[model samples]
Structure formats: structure tokens, C-alpha cells
Target: MMLPGFPEAAPLAGLAGGLLIGLAAALMLLGAGRVTGVSGIVGRAFGINDSGMSWSSAWTFVIGLPLGAFLVATLKGGFEPEFVPLPLLAVAGVLVGFGARLGSGCTSGHGVCGVSRLSQRSLVATATFMIAGIATVAVMGAL
Candidate 1:
């Protein structure tokens, strides 16, 4: 899909974004000995104790995401994606979040970093999630 204002430079923008994300993940791993898995971090933030680290960084990352997006929007004059109704959005978020937890990782963790490391489990999980997402979108469009 073509982004409205980012038409000509979309591919470059995506590559830059992927590079930045890889750099960030690598740095996080190197510096903190932590996997840059948003679901795991967020689970820890909710007092899930799979690790001993304090939830401070997780909280910061979670909070910073939306704040950073807002700042970028202010700087770039970009429009936000349209949301469904609040109730529907809430339900969808809960289900997706649960799925992420149950699957042991989110898309970024599995698709980008894990797959790059040649992890078999992550490869399967990522492929399953991608197919599921595509099928979901197709079904939704058909409805």
C-alpha cells in the first residue's frame, strides 16, 4: 500500500526503518542482555516475573512509543491511522496481546530478530502469524 505523502520514498523509508530497528535491537541486546521483544517487556511491566530486571525500561519503552509517534506526527504532519470504536479496539487489543503472549513473541521479535538468527521455532511461529494475519485481513475485507 502506498502511503499518501511518502509515495516516492517508501521503499527507502522502509529500509531505513528496518535498519534503525535492527540497530536498536542489537544495541539493546548488547547493552542490556535483553531481547527487544515488546510482548515480553510489556508482560514484565505488568509484574510478570520471568526476569529479574525492574519494569522501568519496559514502562519507558511502552510509554515512549506513542509519545514518539506523536512527536513525529507533529514534525512531519502525518495523519494517524483510523481506529475502530473504542470497545472494538479494546477487545481486539486484548485478543492480539494475549496471542502475542501465548505465542511467546510478537512480530518484531519473531519475524525480524529471531528469524535473522535462524531460530526454527521463531521461523514457524512467524510464518504462522503472517499467514493468520493475511487470512484475517482477507476475511475481514470479504465481510
Candidate 2:
């Protein structure tokens, strides 16, 4: 689906975004021997014991995300998303994040890196997430 307010450059923009993401993931794995798993990174942020360098890099990446977006907007220009509501967004974020942790990976981990590695568990988890997302949208549409 076309995102509201994104220019005709959206597809190219998306390609660039995907390329950057893949490059970052590949670089992380090659350089630090770490999987770019958002849930795992967040878990490490919450005091999970792992390699100090990996945890620190994960933390840096997490912190850099918003900053990078801001820089991109400054360079490329874009619309900022309007929130449904702060409280609702916060609650949903917490629930989704917890679910990601419980599922042992986030969308990026399962959808990108894991699938690329041909991991069966990642395939199943990614499928489950996609199905759940579709169902949620359908139910919301009905409501």
C-alpha cells in the first residue's frame, strides 16, 4: 500500500532503506558476530547478560534510529506520523514489544536475517506474525 504523503519517490526510498538495513545487519554479523535482532537487543538493554560489545552496539543502534530518521528528514524531507493517541500508542507498543520478546525475535530478526539464513523457526515465527498482523487489520476494519 502507498503510504499517505510519501512522494512518488517512495519505492526508491524504500529500496534505499532496505539496502541500508541489510548492509547494517551484514556488517554487524561480519564485524561483531551479532544478529540484528531487535528483541534480543532490547532484552540486552534490560540487563540480559551477553557480550559487552554486542550489547553496547545494540544500544547504540537503538539510540541512533531516531537520530538517523531526523537526519533523513532534514536531508530528504517527509511527513511526521500523526499518532492515534499517546496512551494508546504507548500501551500497544509495550504489548507488541513484549510479544516480540516472547516470540524470541522481532519482525526484522525473523523476516530479514532469520529468513535469509533459512531458519525453520524464523520462517514459522515470521508467518505467525504476518498472519496475526493481517487478522488484526481485518478485525479492526470490521470494527
Candidate 3:
């Protein structure tokens, strides 16, 4: 299951990335009073019509995601994540969108910021998603 062009796992790298994500999310919340939820950001950017951030700002944030990734990949020589078939990826993306709608926010909003704020609803939503994710992995492994 090793991805091409990628070295072995680097827990330090993962930790640094997580820390950076937390810092970014924290900055978005504390600085602009906005949630750093990428799904909502992208949804609004593409005219899904949420009422918080302006299209310009949201679009910038969305564009920054891939651009930042590319920058990191370039700095590190390259990047390769394990590939999934396009059809399955599409289905999974759709399901994730549906779930995000149902849950009111993605992991960034609920899992990081909301949970940090000790929000009861976000706590429940985060737990539900985590459990569902674990169960889904178990079922998939069985399959």
C-alpha cells in the first residue's frame, strides 16, 4: 500500500502538519471570527451560498489549499498519496458532502474549533463522525 515517490511514515512531519492546521484554524476563528471549515468554504466559493465569508475571501482560502500543498510538495521534492479509483473517490466525496451538511460542519469547524470551544453540539457531531469513520473502516476491512 506504499504510495509511489513517498518515503516511510514520518510522525514528526504529521505532527507538524497537525500543529500548523490547528494554528491556522485558531487564527481564522480568533482573528476573523470565522470557522476554518474547508467544505463550507469551497461550497460557498462554488455558489453553494452560505452566509458567512464573502466569495472573494472564501475563494482565496480554497485556492490557498492546493497552492499551499503544491508549495510544500515542491519544497519536499514531490508528494504522493495513496490513490483511489476515481469512481470510488467521487462517491466518497458525495457522501462526505452529504454528511457535512447533515452534521452542520466538517472536522475543522466541529472537531478542531468547536470542540476546542467546548460546544455540546460540535462534541456530539464530532464523536458521531469519528465512530462512523471507525465503523466504516472496520466494515471495509471485512469486505
| Candidate topping lDDT | 3
Among the numbered candidates, top TM-score falls to: 1
- Candidate 2: worst-modelled 10 consecutive residues by lDDT: 46-55
| Model 1, residue pairs in steric clash | none
**Which regions of candidate 2 are displaced past 4 Å?**
1-6, 48-55, 78-84, 141-143
lDDT by residue for model 2 over 42-128, one digit each (tens)?
A: 667766645345556668877898889988887866757676988998999899888886888789888888999999989999999
Instruction: Indicate the residue-level lDDT of 87 in model 3.
Output: 100
- Provide the lDDT at 99 for model 3: 85
lDDT of 1 by residue, 26-141 (tens): 98788888778878777788886554446888888788878977887788887768868999989988997988878888988888779988999899999999899899999997
* lDDT by residue (tens digit), candidate 3, 47-81: 99684889999989988998999999889888777
The whole-model C-alpha lDDT of candidate 2 against the native structure comes to 0.82
State candidate 1's TM-score.
0.84
Residue-level lDDT for 56 in candidate 3: 96
Clashes per candidate (backbone, < 3 Å): 0, 0, 0
The TM-scores of all predictions, comma-separated, are 0.84, 0.82, 0.83
